[model samples]
Target: MLQLREVNIDDKQTFDKYITKHNPQISELNFTNIFMWRNSYKFRFGEVGEMLCLISVPDNDEPFAFEPIGAYTKEAFIQAIDEISNYFKEKNWKLVFKRVEEDKLDYFKEYFKNGIDITDDRNNSDYLYLSEDLINLKGKKYHKKKNHLNSFTKNYEFEYVKLTDDLIDECIRINEEWCKKRSCEQHRNLYCERLANLEALTNFKKLKYEGALIKVNGKYEAFTVGELLNSDTAVIHIEKANDDIRGLYNAINQQFCENTWKNTVYINREQDLGIEGLRKAKLSYNPVKLVNKYTITCK
Candidate 1:
């Protein structure tokens, strides 16, 4: 028997324990945003023993149920859906599922084939899939990336350090500088809150073992933090570079992929959020593939 329950960050120990045991990379998702979102919006939960399951539905909508953040067996997923459907049916609201990632298409396919309307929302920008086997480029492609890295390394001492409280503070300073120079207009408060949450989480040594900081000329220039999504996948949560430094972004990005994620078969750089410049930057990497996502609504 499965039961659903809402999550509270006050119980961070239990929440973090589950994340570390099941999926540590999803640690980024275990933030105040999720807590606030779940608080304002009612979510369905299924509990089996110590394991807790989550299913999100729009607060304004009564019938729709979004998928859970944690992984589960196909049978468990289906059972969760059935439970949500029954609850929504009683409320007379049509059920809708949004932002289903491409990897989980089979789950939606099973239900859609039975007569549910599925639509590709195309909400996210192109996702880049990096090959684990670093491209063996001998000519232009190889030279271009090599030149930038070499130039960055020669001019600035490349230092890859474990993420620490001091490193995070430096990252914040660099990020604020970049934002100011770029005249970033959106999500200023949200960004600050997210960074604060990230800083707080970084203190958990076990959870943030993979995060790194890149310093140039003994000064913080860039930083990135991420974790293994699964056995073969690593997902980058946050990456920022000093805007004043030339090629710092390229240098840190390439180095991180070359060093930290070299063992992983695939690197999910994640979504670009439909930002034009960001989309182009991600596309420029020449991803091996793209993961398409979709949304489903019952008519």
Candidate 2:
């Protein structure tokens, strides 16, 4: 019998081994993402042959999975999916795959052999931007962003520093203050985000994430944490800025890329969760790609 255990920090190396081989583009495929949101989603995983099977048991919803992570052949991959599907079915839960990347749709078709319910998970799709575009803020597309960045630069005497364990506290403070201003406690998503951000910082060194923070007038007002998602791209896990500070979000976003991820070809800012305001903000940056995610119900 396959048994699933809650996702933990110790799972990073094992998950990384499988994830590295797969070189996944979807945001949820990473171990950091799995671990950070484990509290909210009640994520659990188990090993099945050469694959790692992860499932999310959200309190308010049916348990679901992302496509299994690892190297696989057609037969082995389909077998792994069947194993996971059975794991849920035993408990009377219908297994569905969430955040399945666009490229993997064919695999599901093969598994079903007839038809499957594949729906767009546009809300969870990640937004990817060219690193250079963010760094330079050039051209007509980025006109307003450049102006915001310019306004921030001109008005604030700010310092940008590479994030380290010692700087983690300041970053947490910034997030906390931001939460207070917005009354994050009143919002479920925001409250969970606070927990997730704390988890990330608490395990910053363990997870081996690279990050940067900004100081305006000797106080930290903004920060972001990210790590390499694949060979060509880096993914930002968390970014927070003080709402009172004009243009601070723009300042931190540009500087974080310039300082930490310049060598990477693309910066993945992750998902907007279908929030209209968030969608609009992400669109304003003019993402080069909106990585599509899907939810596929097995037949």
Candidate 3:
């Protein structure tokens, strides 16, 4: 039987070593995301054969695991499938895998023909943007973005500071204020997101994240957090701003990319979760591509 354990910041080094070898392209592959949402999603981890597996046991949903990490050959994945199947067999549920990247789909077909069903998971597909496109905001496509940034600059005396221990509390305060304004208590997803953001802020340094804070009139108004997803891509996990303020979103988005991730070729803002407003907002950025994701259900 595979021994599973709760995910923690202490597991970062081990996770990083395995992650680097595999270099997954999906947003969920990042360790920080796993650590922060550990509670909300009931995440657990273990090793089976040569594969590192992450399982999500949400309260209301049927439990599922992510596509296995590390060097997963077809044979190794089959072993992992067996291990997961035995663990969940008592539930009388099919073993399901989420966040299965496009390139990895063929590996599933190699082992399970009639047992597996792979389908597009558009809600979880990641949006990929050119880092240069976000930082430069050049051409007519970005006219509105530029205009918003300009208005923010003209109206407020603001400072963009690299996030540090001293500013974490301020960021938390601003996050609370933002949540209150949005009535997070009424929305379960937003409320859960607030908890995840708090965990990230509390363990920012331990998680090895790079962050930026925005101060308008010398008060914290916005902040963003991200990390290197792979050699060529940086993934943004959290970005919150005061929507009431006319261009704070555009300004922070531009400045954060310019200051922190200029070396990367692409930026992944993660998923929109099928929210109409969020989907529209992400689409407006004119992503260069969408990293298609899929769900694999084993019957």
Candidate 4:
């Protein structure tokens, strides 16, 4: 079994050394994603055959590995997964890989054949959009979205400001009210998401985040955080708005893209998690493609 260590804020530099070199598609490939949800997922990392290996052990579920980061060769990956499988066996848990990106799916199918089940995890797949489409909101497809942004612009005295550490208090205030309205206290997933939000904001600069916030009618109402996932795509880690104010969500999203991410070709808004309303909202923007993630389990 490979030795592993807990993921910490200080480990960002170590992880980014591997991640930045790889061309990652899914949102999970970034350190911020792992670091922010470290509480729920309990992520640990170590090197196997010189490739960075990651594993998640949730408090309520069986442990599983993610696709190894850094350079890939069939020999190195096979050895890494083999070691990971044995590590899980020692703990008496089945070998599993969750959120495996599409490009790496072939490796598992060809090398680890027997008793392996590979299924698409649609609920966790990322929604990718053309940065231009999101920023410009051009044509008939964006007619409704354009209207919403226009309404917010015309009605509210709003300022689109850079999300800095000084505004953390205002961000927290909006989040507290948003959590109550969404009934996050009664829902496990929502509660986990709330914690993720706090984790991102608290470590904003350390995580390499570039974010934006909307001040509507002299009050802080909405904000979003995101970072470059790879050479071409920027993934949004968090987005929150005061739902009581119509079009605030649209304003925050549009302003963030227009102001922060125009240099990137694609924007990864991330998954809907099988939430009906969330799915509808993401779909309304018309994603260019869906980056499908898969889960593989050895039976």
| Ten residues in sequence with the least summed lDDT for candidate 3 | 85-94
Candidate 2 worst ten-residue window by lDDT: 71-80
- Backbone clash tally (model 3): 0
Q: Which has the better lDDT: candidate 2, or candidate 4? A: 4
| lDDT, candidate 2, 230-261, per-residue tens | 99999999999886788899999999898888
Each model's C-alpha lDDT? 0.59, 0.89, 0.89, 0.89
Q: Using TM-score as the measure, what is the rank order of every candidate, best first?
A: 2, 4, 3, 1
- The regions of model 4 sitting more than 4 angstroms off are none
Alpha-carbon deviation at 248 in model 2, angstroms: 1.2
TM-score (C-alpha) between model 4 and the true structure: 0.97
Error of 2 at 83 (Å): 0.8
Q: Each model's TM-score, in the order given?
A: 0.73, 0.98, 0.97, 0.97
- What is candidate 4's lDDT per residue for 38-122, written digit by digit as tens? 9999999998775789999999998899988888888888888877888888999888899999899888887777758999999
Residue 1 in model 1: lDDT? 30
**For model 3, which pairs clash?**
none
TM-score of 3: 0.97
Model 3, span 174-287: residue lDDT tens: 889989998998998899999999999999778979999999997889999999999999999999988889999998899999999999999999999999999998998999
lDDT of 3: 0.89
- Candidate 1 residues 1-299, lDDT tens each? 33456665455565555444454222224433344345345545554333444556644544345454445567766766666666666766677766555555677668556676667754443354554433332356457656766677777777877776556677667666666665554765444444544543445454444567787777777887666666667776667887567777776676677778887777667666677787877776666666665667765
**Model 4 residue 251 lDDT?**
87
RMSD of 1: 4.8
Q: After superposition, how far is residue 99 of candidate 3 from its true place, in Å?
A: 1.1
